[model samples]
Target chain A: MLGDALSLSLGYNATLVTLGATLLGAAAGMAGTFLYLRKNALISDAISHATLPGLGIAFLIAVAFGWDGRQLAILLGGSALSAALGLYFVNWLTRETRLTQDTAIGCILSVSFAFGVVLFTIIQVLPAGRKAGLESFLLGSTAGMLYSDALLILVLSIITALVLVVFLRPIKLVTFDASYSETLGISVRRVDFIILTLTLAVTVLGMKIVGLILIVALLIIPAVSARFWSEKTDIILITSTAFGALSGYIGSAISAVSAGLPTGPIIVLCAFGFFLISFLFAPKRGVLAVALKHYQFQKTVHLTQGLLSLALRQSIYEPKTRRLLQRFGYIRADGVVTEVGKSLAAKTLLNEKRWSYWQETLRESDQFDGQVVFSLMDIETKLTQDQILLIDQGLAARKGKKL
Target chain B: MMSGIALVSDKGVLLNAAADDRNAPFTIRGLTVSYGQVPAVYSIDFTAPAGSLIGILGPNGAGKSTLLKAAMGIVPVVSGQVSFFGKPLKEARYQVAYVPQRASVDWDFPATVYDVVLMGLYPILGLLRRVSKADKAKVAESLAKVGMQDFADRQIGQLSGGQQQRVFLARALTQRADVFLLDEPFSGVDAATETAIISVLKILQLEGKTVIAVHHDLSTVSTYFDHLFLLNRKAVAYGSVTKVFTKDNLVTAYGGKLGAAQLDAIGL
Candidate 1:
């Protein structure tokens, strides 16, 4: 795999494939960043859908001249033209009509996708169309490359990506807050226009490998995943680029092994896999991390509440007994409960304090409540002298007429 | 007050007196703006001698913010011009600074306070320009001036509303510009943060840098304002507070259609 990639990146086939994939990846990533940020993720979806008409139109034009539409000029020109028209329609639907942005995008996205499918079918139906080069155009076979097609895709993606990198700050600012960017002497509308144009440009270029069906995912997932790993825009951009490159290479390789598999969907799926891992496992923003953190916080609170209740149950539970509550949550080291061993003991019943802690935990947890409130669940669960006091106080607080 | 820039009143009651000094500043003229077809501002014109502090006063939706945006070339003006030290906005862009309303943005943006302030240098730095030692020094100084030096690298979204406003002020300070346009700089800010921002604005004013602010609160109008533009879709009044901020002028600005029948026109 390694030698194959190097031979590809350095050799004509490899270099062309890698260069095309990487360039397309970067454009997708860059354009996707703005689209994601501006709450216009669906706009890319709309553009992708809308590109079909252009593909159909380009193919129709190609057939009239007895040429294959998969030629870079026809395929990309068709996609770009359709996408551009989709954007214009999007703007028009939003500005001229009473339709909102998403609604307009939806209307255009479905219509264009339908039109593209119709065009693909029409091209296939031609008497000599069996060899019309439709498979490469539809599924994106990066391995079977004619040099010029890859070169055009590379040039277009590079120019678009460079523009994104150059206008990074203003675009990021406008995406985050247009009104704020404007007052800072930056042109909000200009930045907005730049982002929209770049989105269209990158989408058109990426349609070769990333393809219409899965382009938005390739563009969005990498950045979304990278966001969990970094906060600074520079770091986010760098991380996103790295992820984009990795997914692009992996998707291409997968397609090389699987006969007739579409490279664009696979690439998108690869990027999405990375996102799923990041979403579920990342330390900072992952779902499991939040759940575990919440669990630990509750454990600490339960221990503290149990001890305070134990103290309140008796005018003063004996110092040794007073210390019992702490021991249930921790080891009684140096006359104070050490901040250790709480997790294991919460699962046990060593003493009254420990028992009380267990009962409170059960009552607070969904296991005991059947989805009821912790306070109400406390009424159903039995506990020690200390546990009752804690639950009563907690319930009192919940009622808002506090003790 | 982002829009309520500091200045001395007629009685020499120094408003936001901690400014650096009055210096070179931009001149906004004939600025007109409209959102689609509905007019937000029109024939808006004004100037501030290099170091003077001016406040833009108006009731809600009076186009005070629009005036500042037009001056910055952010808003598409139907017709008008803005000059900084007699130069167009693009030519002298780096010489001006803008602080937008704190409420106008979603502070949950994924950026640190340091990065927010660093954006002020973007014009001079350009895209892909690294922050040098000098740039770092400027960011540090701006943060310190707003009493947020320690929080420089902290995430902007984590800060309180007041702290976010301070971070924005620190960003404006980083510009080190001759003119500052702030919109509602003091809204949602605690007293200390308000005073701290005012002190910085005062220092800028004293240093001969002109500051124009869009202010909402009338109570602080006379206190911090040196020059005033009392607006209601058009220039109702412009000049010293005593000359323009009077009952009759305010009545002319907002008290229109007071009749019971006219109340219906204004939605009561």
Candidate 2:
């Protein structure tokens, strides 16, 4: 059943809803990259929450005109207007007052959302709003979505994604360095407006599938998850968009196969799954990779110290060091140093001595400042044979002087 | 003492001439910048000669950096006129390059050294234009100029503080402007980076470009800059290092921050 639903054999409305949700996810992911990079992720929450009042007002207007109040286009337009207003309010509060951006966002988010809840309650009490299905805007219900509604969402998502792609360079430049961008003649204000517009578009379009509350998850989670996987902006962008689309696709399909699951929370859960995976297992920056790197470094330190002890004819007291030395065949199970152990230990000691001597000699020169630290790396890799021989000769001369 | 007086009179004559040169590299008149109600830079007037290395020096909170930012039009000036090559800043912005302090931007931004340097060409590229071979060559040349060719593909944050500063300098060099404004370019940098940056600045000066830097090290003022503008919320002194870098001038600009012993240490 799940396979059929995923393959789009789940009938017409289900397929349209699934495709629309996927496009919305992709668009949100792309636009959210700039928002994330700008460190304004919380603003999207304010914008999305602020959309509820618009949704309620649009329904009222449609009902007053005796038209179907659940019209997706009219409701989306209303949400976009309110979201833009909320964004303006946040900016004004931040610029005109002493309130920080996050404080402004919190202010707008709570007040506007509370007003929206009141509107929702008012609409629920009206006879015309009895079957309005406005509750879907809270957690999103795609079960009874119209064909035209799905198409509208898909089309808007495509447009938003395309716009984001076209303006990605300027947006990235401004976000990374606003002062530099100004000197480059790129208007920081205009780029910021474009980002906010794209963010507004994504939020309004995402409301029908992901709901107002969970849309921020669609906007932030994918971008953040993608960050763990790459150090390149474009790669992170692509990864984020892919993650969003996959979450939307699987979440919508699951909702289609199961009657009771809400699409928004399911999609958000799916995005969270990606974040969890990236957090634990992505290479270089991931938790697991960092832990593994730390473990390898620790093992190297133990093995080197154990070998050095062997070279000095000392006993290994630490159990972990002894086990590591034995595993590497540097020591016998009886805590005795093997032939291999002595030679390796001697080389380690020599490398340590060579590094110290090199540091002392170059104390006045910063030529090898950050790289000359004593590590398990071979000295031959860091210095030429002639340099090593010179150091060795110097060491011999020092010993001769001591004698 | 007589020769010192003669040098001051000579510099005074030069300053007067430069004020009306019209073709001066940079000229600021009655410049005042404020943050909210508090003034940071107040009523400062200065002009730079062609092909000269100038230093803007002051103690902490003395508005040395504020002066640069206001001159570059990055920060709004309360009242002033900043002209570049006899034209307004907007008209001649392309001829001016600015290197903001390294701490002003996030180094962890996702970009390679090459990518950041390539941004120098963004104004010329405009929208819908691809970076051509010549532009790429220019970026490569700038990186090579700063001895950062090996770090072209490395992430920006992976570099040391000095390397990061070098990368910013390379970005500014790619602008190929007639005047360079640097804010604390040598601060927190290693000796090698300082040497590399000073050499590059000297080369720029030799090529007839005006290099104006906000400098902190009073000891290197005479060695690095041919001209100095001493500012402490106002223009304290402005002239050649030998003429203006005096005990009285240091005390005036620093305002009790520089003691007699400290002034003696810098040979003021």
> For each candidate, what TM-score against the reference?
0.75, 0.93
User: How well does candidate 1 reproduce the true complex, by DockQ?
Assistant: 0.23
Write model 1 residue lDDT over A257-373, tens digit each, in one string. Answer: 556777788778888888988889988678898899887666655654444443333233345544545556454535443444444333232334443444555343212222222
Q: Show the colliding residue pairs in model 2.
A: none
Q: Please write out the lDDT profile of model 2 over residues A1-403, one tens digit for every residue.
A: 9999899998998898889888888888888888998988999999999998999999999999999998888999999999999999999999889899999999999999999999999999999888998988888778777788777777877787778767877888898888888877778889999988988988988888889889999999999999999888999999999999999999999988998899999999999999999999999889999999999989988987888788788877999999999999988888778888888989998888887776666333344434424657677987789888888888888789999
Question: Candidate 1: misplaced stretches above 4 Å?
Answer: A1-23, A92-99, A128-130, A133-143, A147-161, A177-198, A298-403, B1-31, B243-268
Give per-residue CA lDDT, model 2, range B1-268, as digits (tens). Answer: 0111122224434573334546677888899999889899999888777677899999999999998888877788999898887788888878999999999998888889998999888878776588899999999999989888778898987888888999999999999898899999999998888999999999998887888999999889999998899989989998888888888888889987877888788766
* Candidate 2 chain B: worst-modelled 10 consecutive residues by lDDT: B1-10
Candidates in order have lDDT scores of: 0.70, 0.86
Give candidate 1's error at residue B178 in angstroms: 1.9
Candidate 2: list runs displaced more than 4 Å. Answer: A305-336, A357-374, A383-403, B1-18
- Residue by residue across B175-266, what tens digits does model 1's lDDT show? 78777889888887767677777788888888867788888666677778777778889988777776766666766777663344543432
**How many clashes does the backbone of model 2 have?**
0
